[model samples]
Target chain A: MVKNRQWRLISFPSGRPEASNWELVETEAPEVAPGHLLVKALYLDVAPYMRGRISPQPNYAAGVGLGEVMVGGAVGRVLESRSPGFAAGDLVVADFAFGWQEYAVLSPGDVRRIDPALAPLPYWLDLFGLNGLTAYFALFDAGAMKAGDTVLISAAAGSVGQIAGQLAKLAGCRAVAVTSSAEKAAWCREAGYDAVIDYRAAADLPAAVAEACPQGVDLFLDNTAGPIHDAAMQNLALDARVVVVGTASLADTFGAPDTGPRFLRQILVARATVCGFLFSDYAARHEAGRARLRRWYEAGRIHSKFDIAEGIASMPDAFLRLLTSRNLGKQLVRLEGD
Target chain B: MVKNRQWRLISFPSGRPEASNWELVETEAPEVAPGHLLVKALYLDVAPYMRGRISPQPNYAAGVGLGEVMVGGAVGRVLESRSPGFAAGDLVVADFAFGWQEYAVLSPGDVRRIDPALAPLPYWLDLFGLNGLTAYFALFDAGAMKAGDTVLISAAAGSVGQIAGQLAKLAGCRAVAVTSSAEKAAWCREAGYDAVIDYRAAADLPAAVAEACPQGVDLFLDNTAGPIHDAAMQNLALDARVVVVGTASLADTFGAPDTGPRFLRQILVARATVCGFLFSDYAARHEAGRARLRRWYEAGRIHSKFDIAEGIASMPDAFLRLLTSRNLGKQLVRLEGD
Candidate 1:
């Protein structure tokens, strides 16, 4: 009999999640139920949104409970199919709650058919998936981005920010990136960002942003809603648009009182607009967004990097990389690959 | 020569401006320039926005300089005209930077002609002017409030809030008012609000708002950006809209850091939209908006009250009343006869 190994939440976290908060459990691979497919995970995504799911605070989606499989996205190969839609060796991509496992029994509706010939397996979890979709909707729909707009993206070298910067360039907008390390800054510039602010080195973030964007930020892709958000708020142009894409910086402060300068006056003075975005909100248009992103990728107009960590044991550290912004691209834990 | 008695800001206040912060000065009215008109102040307005202008902090407009005439709106009569657009004794309404003065040398372009036969002189400064314009644009343009929307308006007994509440009802929406006193709550009900919460007495303002707005707030007219704003933020419905119309609660906190729960999670969870509003953005639509407001007033479909403080000497206290929300209606300092 084959064994199925999974990581389950053992406790909730008050601050940064630690490796000890999770437990790796081993059990026999469960018998596939009728209309369900038994799949083996190949690539697991480590995304910023997972921080919200593991927190004690309430999130947009239900939080992971103690003893439950942690929720995340993954690309997998169907090993056995009781469902007619899937077959043995067929590859698919899905954001499943049972992501931290070697094998999962999933309903056919839980995943989408994906071909590796179109894109790499990990690409399905990165540029062709939620990250790319976020950047698209954030700039075009939520931000109402126009040509020549000065777009500022936080976490600029990360998967979503990199894609957003490239998309901004394609639309004739100047993109400025905010990152922590010089390595990330170089990557962001290569991704078409006109300027990159190493937030760690920027003594005065607001002034640095203002100097980088002399005309003021017309569109702010707020991937981290804390200090970077505040600095961008202080530099919005008249009628600027702010799309709250993620809260990497506020991961620990979500339930706590986060202190900052009152922004109403600045908002009023700039007549800015703030919109909160979740990729799921555009679920209806996701397939279409993926198609468009795929087209851009083939045209060589867009590119993304995956900061891959090997083995199931690296999953905890892979996810932890998001909190400290240690990953320069889309982070993934690869269990088995070429 | 007529005497021009004006209130000049003598000092910038640390917290709330006291009566002593302003000094009344008497000077002879200057001669009108070739294109200017001499105007006699009839009804001088005291508005919440004036608080922003009086503060030393930079605002949408330049702040009132120390030893400079305080900035506000006024309705007056042309004493003498040196410009072709106006004539002597013509009644006009203008939001002047020198509104506290009894008489002033003016430019014809500085004022708009308003007939007293159309509405009361003060109505030009209230329902037909900045306050009304603010309400119309905030709900219709910025907030994007639709029919059947559940709207929560803060500072509900004040000029902009009262007007916004009545407009919300006229649009077939459910209006909930947030005010400080029982008397103000009654006035809000009289203005067509279905629910009124006395914020001063409510121990848990968020709970009270949630109870009053059982369906959750679809649109929030945030007239004050402080505790009330936070309360509304906690109760937003899916895809709710928040239009910031004032910062009465942030009057003293603009330059200082204001601590509150990090709202990124709350905002993203609800997929909310927040917009900052200013009436000047709708300047081109003023005449059209005034015409609509005048029709509503004539039809008895809308109503507002003026809390008049007598004479130029009372201007300081009249503005001071705004800080404490002591005035139940549109606060104005009357310098002329009824």
Candidate 2:
């Protein structure tokens, strides 16, 4: 029997997550049952969305209960299998259902087969997984992005942010990025953004966004819904479309109410539409989206940078880094290297 | 030359209008020019949207300047015509450009001819005019009201609200009304709402809304963007559509920012869409919309009630009644006998 080490939620976060809120536990990995397989976590993804899973609020999904294994996604390898669909040593990727652990017992339906030979294992989570699917549907479907749209993407150097900017560029839109640092802004510019606003360095975010989009933003792909959202609200072109994908800046207030200048007036003034969507809504067409994303990746039309931490012990820290917007790209913890 | 009495904006309001903000002026009416017609005002419209036009804010339309005629809509009879499209004795309806006056000078393009023989003159400003068309397009296009949708309409006894609630019922959706008082709620019930919530009397607004809409609101027609908006935000069903049609409650704060719970989190949690649109955006298709509304009105499928204040002197008071939710159905001012 293989030994499994996993992190379990001890308490819900009051504000930002604390290390004491999680407890590490060791147990024997469960033997495979009929129609099920066991996977050893290769690389665990730490995303901003995970913060919602720990909060007791009206989230899109059910929250992780106290003493429950902390939820996450990971690229894993099949260690043992009782299902005909999977064999030992086969590579797989699990989304959200994969807890923050060294080993997870899952059914064949719980995971998708992935080929490491096609690209690096971490790339499945970073570029070809949730981030890619999210950016594609949120930008084109929710945002109604079209040719010549002035697309403003917040969190432009992060996982989904990077992919959305490149996709906007591919669609012949003027891609303007709002990132936290000069280095990330430089990276965004090199990645084909028409203009980059380093939000942390700007004296006035709304002015910076206005300067970058002189004609006003036609499609604002909002991932950070705080000051950046307010700035975009103040600079919408006629009939603008805003897609709310993530609230990276509001992680601390997930379970409580936060105040901001109401956006309804701006929405009316510009005749704009604001929509909120989750990637799971497009799960049926994931394969199609992944195919186009893979083509873009192979042709170097899209690129991704991995910001990885060392081990299972770094899971909470990696997530904190993501919550604080410290990670440059996809934040991941390597339980074992690819 | 005709003697005319009109109300001019003397100052912008800080909160609600207090009757001291308008100036009554008596002057000789301008004669018909090369392309303009002179009309004697019969009925003037008082609406919630007019509140935005008086404020110095980023509204959908420009604010009425001090010393300018208080902007409004009216049904009138042409006294003299200098345009080929119209003749003396023609009945017409002018929108926005028709001031709160006894006479107006307008170009042929500024007004639409009305057949007084088809319906009562006041119906042109109520059931068969902006109110009906706004309800039609907003419910179908912006609210995306599908058959069987549980629709929640705020300010349900107001002009557009009454029409929208009925339109949702005609489309086979469950029409629910949120009104200010029990009397208005009773009117909404008589008008075919499946449920009615008297927001002013509700001990817990959210609880009242949830109890009324046990299945949650599928389409929320937001007319008053304050507490009613918050209650609806707390109870959105999956894939709900929220159409911001008017801001009756926010009128007092139109030129300044107001604090409210941020709605992005609620929006994302429900995977919902919120859109803001103006009836002017559908101006090109107004004729078709008016025809349908006329058919509905003639068929007894739709209804309208007029809460009219007498004479041009009552214009500001009639408008203030609308702003304070003191008037029900289509608020109007009769400058002359119908």
Candidate 3:
């Protein structure tokens, strides 16, 4: 029998999660069942979405119960298998139901195989995984982005934002990014964004956005939905499309009452549409999204960056940093590096 | 030549419009010029949308200029004509640019002929006019109503609301109505709404809506923005569509700051869409919408009621009653007897 170390939820977080909210424990790995396999986690992802799962209030996805393993996604290698489709050395990615642990006993249906030859292993966790699929559908399908359209992306240096901005650029659209820091803004500019707005430094975000995309924003991929969303609403062009992908800025007020600028008049006058997008809605078509992302990655049309913590024990800190926008790119923890 | 009496805007309204905001003036009517005709007003429309045009801040449609006639739609008789297509004694409907007046000289392009054989004269001012077109396009195009969908319409006793609720029912959907009073609620039930919620009597609007629509709301036609909008946000079904058609509740706060519930979280979780809909967007497709509405009206699938004010001079009071939700069904002014 092997030992498995897992981070489990001890309590639901109120505002921002603290270290005491989770408890790290070690247990004997369970033996593989008839249709299951043993997985040794190679890389675990810590995303903004995980915050919702740890909350007591019901979120879009199911919340992690107290005393349960923290829910997340990870890339793992099959150590042992009972299913005919899987072998000991096969590399795979866990479904969203998997936990943030060093080892997991999972049914073959709960994971999908990944080819290491297509892209780097980390790319599977960053661009080719949830982040890539999110950017792919949010930009192309929900956003309805077209050539010559001006696209604005908030949280431009973060995981999904980075991919969305690059995709907009690839579609022959003008891409404008909103970032909190000058460093991140520089990175966004280097990533082919036509203009970069340091939201922290701008006196008026809407004015800055207007100056950047003088034609006005036709599509906006919003990750931080607070003041950024209000500004985007004010700057929408006629028939604009706004995709609400994440609310990192409103994490603390998720279950509370929060008020911002009223958008009814603006949206009505502009004849704009605001859509809330989730990748799970397109679960059956993820392969199609992945195929397009793979083509982009192989052609060097897209790039992904990972801000990885060294060990499985670093997940909580990494996640907290992600919430505060301290990390530069996709936040991850390397449980067992190659 | 005839004496023309006109109600002109003297100043922009701050809150609800008052009598002093308009000035009644008498002038000699101009002769019919080339391509122009002299029209004697028959009926005039008073709608919630007219409030936006009277405000100081520009709305989707052009604002009524100070000291100019308040822009609106009116049905009149061609008293004298210079155009070959129009003849004296022919009935016609003026475009939205027409002023509130008893007599005027208009270009033939500024009006359309109305067939008396199709519907009553007042119907041209109510259900067969812009109001009908608004309900038709807003429900079909913006709301995207599907059969069996649970449709919730706010201001269910008003002009557009009354028509929209019946249209939803005719489309094989479950129609629910939200109104300010029990009288209106009873009227909504008589009009074929599957359920009716008296918002003023309900302790909790969202809870009442959920109880009324156990399956949740698939489409929401929101005419009042303040608290009703908040409640609708809280009760959205997955993939819900919210059409922001009017803001009667926010008319007092149009130029001032008004804060209420933030809808981003609810929309994101439910994967819903909130669209600001204006009838002007479908101006090019008005005939298509009218054709559909005409069929429904002729087949008795739709009904319209008008609260008629005695004369053109009663427009301000009629409009104020509409703002306060005191008037039921479509509000209209009789400028001349049949």
Best model per lDDT: 2
Better candidate number, 1 or 2, judged by lDDT: 2
- In terms of docking quality, model 1 is incorrect
**Worst window of 10 by summed lDDT in candidate 3 chain B:** B329-338
All candidates in order of DockQ, best leading: 3, 2, 1
Q: Which stretches of candidate 3 lie over 4 Å from their true place?
A: A261-338, B261-338
* Model 1: CA > 4 A from native: A258-338, B258-338
Q: Write the per-residue lDDT of candidate 1 for residues A1-338, one digit (tens) a residue.
A: 78776678789777766666677787788899999988877665556666677876655557888998767666788889999888999998775444666678888877877878755566566555566556666677667888999999987766577778877886789999998777667767766689999998999998999999999888888777668877887777755677766666666565665355233322332344434333233445534544443353345443323345654333334433532234433343333321
Order of models, best TM-score first: 3, 2, 1
DockQ head-to-head 1 vs 3, winner: 3
Q: After superposition, how far is residue A82 of candidate 1 from its true place, in Å?
A: 3.8
The Cα error of candidate 2 at residue A111, in Å, is 1.6
Q: Show the colliding residue pairs in model 1.
A: none
lDDT of 1 by residue, B1-338 (tens): 77676778788777755666677788898888899888877666656666667776656567888998877667778889988889998988775443566777777656778868755566666665566566666677667879999999988777677777877886789999998878778777776789999998999998999999998888888767678877877677755777666666666555665455233322332334434433334445534544443353346443323345654334335434532234533344433321
For candidate 3, lDDT tens digit of each residue in A9-118? 89876876666777778788888889898988766655666776777765555788999988867777899999999999999987464676677889987788887875
* Candidate 3 local Cα displacement, residue B137, angstroms: 1.2
